[model samples]
Each structure stands twice: as structure tokens, then as C-alpha cells.
Target: MKTSPRLESALKKLYTAFHSNKLNPECNKHCAVGNILDNTDIWKHLSDHHGSIKLNYIGTVHQRIGRKFNGYSPLELLEIEATFLKACGYQLPLHYKNTKPKNPTDKIILFKGLSDVIRILCEMDGIDNVMDYTKLFEVKNQKAFYDIV
Candidate 1:
């Protein structure tokens, strides 16, 4: 599939965010590391199964990972991610559960639950594909804040 320059630029930004480990801080503690580890295995499986499945939208990709764990509802997460993606200037493809395509090859994109706005931002920075699990730790450090009186 051909990717637009605007999309490519947005993806580059997303990649930076991912590479910088910015969004990992927000993942639920119990699930965060596990998800990252599982994702690596899943990526391997996907690569073997589908032979290099291209990620047009990283937020959507994460939503799939969220679905595999059975904690959060995938659809809800996808919606939240979609909202965030839109904020980052990427138009989300329509989502219809009942009419979802039957074949993986037929599907352009698939998003499950509420989207993580921050995660979407990270993806827009060009962080779609991840190789190592430890890299997620870099995103765990949250900045401290002081309130004005």
C-alpha cells in the first residue's frame, strides 16, 4: 500500500515518540511489561504468519495487543486511540464491528477499544515496530510537577 507524505511524516513523529519511550509510562503497571514482551513474541508470530504485516497505524496495532490480554475492552481502547490519532492529524478509518471484514487480507485497519491519546501521539512520532522488550522501560519515567498556589 502506498503511504502519503503527510502520513509518513506523522509516522516518523510517532516513531520518535515510541523510540523515546514516552508512552510506556501510561500502560497499566501489571500489563505494561507483559504486553511489551508479549508483543515481541506476537510480532514474531505475525511476521511468520502474515509475512511482514505493515502497520499503517500503530495505535490500531496496540489495540490488538490490548485485546489479546482480556483486561480492557478492545473497542473502547480503539476509540480512545482513534481520538488521539485524529488530534495528531491522522484520519481514522471507519470501525464497524458487526460488518468487520472476514479475511485479514481484506482488512485495511482494525481497532478494538478506547484509544490511548498519548499512545497515538507516540505512534504519530514514528514508533510503529518494536523489537526489544526492555526498550519499553525508557517510557516509564514520569516527570514530576509542581502546582502553583
Candidate 2:
């Protein structure tokens, strides 16, 4: 798949941070993209498994045959997000870890989350994907960017 300029730019930034020794190697495992692809059990089946069962409060009104379509859905949007990274031949951003490092001198620190990469690429492709996981959104350098969010 052809990647947009924004995806390329995000990839460059990721490599820059990685090369600068600012990101941890395990960051990919915890990325939003990774969380979906690694954690979610997904597979294509010709027919439903008889052993599998689910309780839907409502019938499969959305599905033509009481089954999900093989395409993008609101809840499964993240399912295909991994493809975006693959298309760009890149991975997600290094997010700030939830816990602090034991040693103060540790150089392996995380940055922002995967949404940063997705947003830039999506915006460039005219796919409006907005998300921010920052604890506190701040504008320290207004002159540096055309938009803060």
C-alpha cells in the first residue's frame, strides 16, 4: 500500500527517537497497535463455530446473516490499524510508561503513544482519526505547529 507523506514523516520521527536512545526496545509490545493485534483473537471462518457462543442484547440487526461483515466496523476499527503501520513499513510511537524507572540514570524512557503516529498519517490521508492519551495537553511551542491537537 502507498503511504502518505505524514506516515513517512512519522516513521522518520520514530527512527530519530530510537536512534537517539530515547525509546525502549519493548515499546512496540505496549503500543496501541500492538495491543490490538497481539491481544485480540481474530480469524476468518467460513462458518460460525458451534462451540462458540455470545450473548448479544440485540439481535444481529446490523449483520445481514447474523454475522459481522468482513470490513471496518466502529468497534473493530483498531483491528485494521496495524495494517496502516505495516503499509508505512513502520511501528507505533514510544509512549511514556505508566510506572517510573527504578534507577534515575536509566536512559530507556518512553515518549508519547501510538495515536501520535496514527493521527499524523490519518490526517494526511484525509482520514479523520482524532485521539490524545496525554495526561495533560500543553502548548509549549505554539510557533512550531499549525495545530496543537
Candidate 3:
């Protein structure tokens, strides 16, 4: 599926922001990621509906029928979801999940933007075709030091 122009624009902006990596001694990774997500309209629907990013993020991802990712923070969960989807070769807006991992690796590469992540998050609660939706993308040789991915 093609992303809406507004979503696309948000993704491009987020992509640019990600590359910029605002340098500040006080800034943390979660804040950096959250700030980018906060700046976009991707998660606005859920956030507003749930009254907070933390709640909407948790409810959407936790209630979803596909790959469910959660963390101590919304941004961390968003990163995990995006990284998992990108690893499976899913382009932005399209989706695949629930596939069995073949020799699952510890590494997950995240290349998509916040738009991609928001779509994935929104899909979790919808009715999914069990046959078509079961696909989990695996990664190559890389180790994750963090608990999220």
C-alpha cells in the first residue's frame, strides 16, 4: 500500500532528522527517538485517542494481531517494531508478520521511518489473515546489546 502524501512528508522529515542526530550532552536516545516521533503526525491519531503516547503505543502494539513489540518506553517499542518490519523486506505502508524465524539472529536493522512505524502500530489491532500475515523477517550476523531489539 502507498502511504498518504502527508505521511510520506512526515517520513521524509523524520528521515532527515534521524540523519541529523542533534548533538546535546543532555539528550538521551529515547528522547531523540521520541522527539522525532513526536514531531510527526504518524502516531498522532493513536496518541490523541489514548490521551498519551505511552498508552496509545502500548495499546496498539499490545492489542495487534501481528508482530507485537513493547518496551519500557514508546520510542523504544517504536524502534523495535520498525526494525523488525524492515528486516523482513517490507516497504513502507505494506506489512508482513507472524512468520517463523529461521535461525533467528540477535540483530535487527531499522531503515524505515516513523510513518512506516505508525502503520505497523496501527495494524496490530486489525483483523489479520492468518495465512498471509504470518511472516517474521530475520537479520544477519549482528548482536544486540539492548533489550528491546
Candidate 4:
């Protein structure tokens, strides 16, 4: 399946970050959106706080003018961050008192966040989710379509 160059590039960066133990849900510079934006915290300025979808003045201006950062609009970047944080069990509009994972660096937790971010990225590009595995459980003639082993 063909994918946007931007999506391809973002996925590559995410994969590297996930495997290198650099992906962190709590850190702006190491989260899913951070990795896609080349591990930069500049995207944080798009919102008033972390894990928020509400765009600030600058973010609103950029979105109004259709400005894209590394191929995603300001709003889209915010959505990606929010999605990732949510998947990692973080409360919205992250705060010191908000609920968050105990082990933010756990590989299993990070993988879940990455999976959700990838799904959103694919959705943004109008493509099927590559991480979806439910197809393997499809039934045909009352039998499983694919072997689990």
C-alpha cells in the first residue's frame, strides 16, 4: 500500500525511537509527536499545556494559515500527542495532579502508545491501520481464517 512520504518518515522515526528506548509518554521531546517532529519540544508551544488538543494563539494562527510542521497541521499534531498520551494512560491536559502511568518508560506501555499514534497517523493519511490484527481472527465457513501458531 502506498503511503505519504511524511507518514513514512514519521513511522521510521517512531520505530527508531521505540527500539532505542527513547520513546517516553511523559516527556515532550521523546513522545510520539516529539519523535515524529525530530525529537523537538517546539510542538509543545502549539498548546497551552501537555496532552491537550486545544490550540493556543500561535497554534491557531498556524492552523488558520494551513501551516504544517513536518507534514502535520498544528491541530493534527495536538491530536497525535493527545492520542498518544491517552493510550499511555495519561489524563488530558497533563498536570502534576493528573493520573498517569506508574512506569512511563515501560516498553509495553510505550508500544501501546505507539500503536495508537500509528493508527491515527494512518487514519490521517486515509489508509488502513497496519497494526490491526483482527483480520487473523476472521471466520470463514465457521472456521478461523488464519492459524494462530
Which portions of model 4 show Cα errors greater than 4 Å?
139-149
- Give the alpha carbon lDDT tens digit for every residue of 1-149 in model 3: 34444344434544564456531111222222333444433433333321123436544664453432221234444443344334434343322443423322212323322334545433442423222322343334664333333
Query: How many clashing pairs does model 2 include?
Result: 0
The lDDT ranking, best first, is: 4, 3, 2, 1
What is candidate 2's lDDT per residue for 22-70, written digit by digit as tens?
4332333323322333323342122132111222323223333544323
Instruction: State each candidate's clash count.
Output: 31, 0, 6, 0
lDDT of each: 0.33, 0.36, 0.36, 0.92
What's model 1's lDDT at 11? 42
Minimum summed lDDT over a 10-residue window in model 2 is located at 44-53
Q: Which scores greater on TM-score, model 1 or model 4?
A: 4
- lDDT score, candidate 1, position 81: 37
Clashing residue pairs in candidate 2 (N, C-alpha, C atoms within 3 angstroms): none
Per-residue C-alpha lDDT of model 4 across residues 57-105, encoded as one tens digit per residue: 9999999999999999999999999999999999988998999999999
Candidate 1 lDDT over residue span 25-127, tens digit each: 2232211221233322232222221112233354256566764322223333333333533333333342332222243211121121112433442344455
Model 4 misses residue 32 by how many Å? 0.8
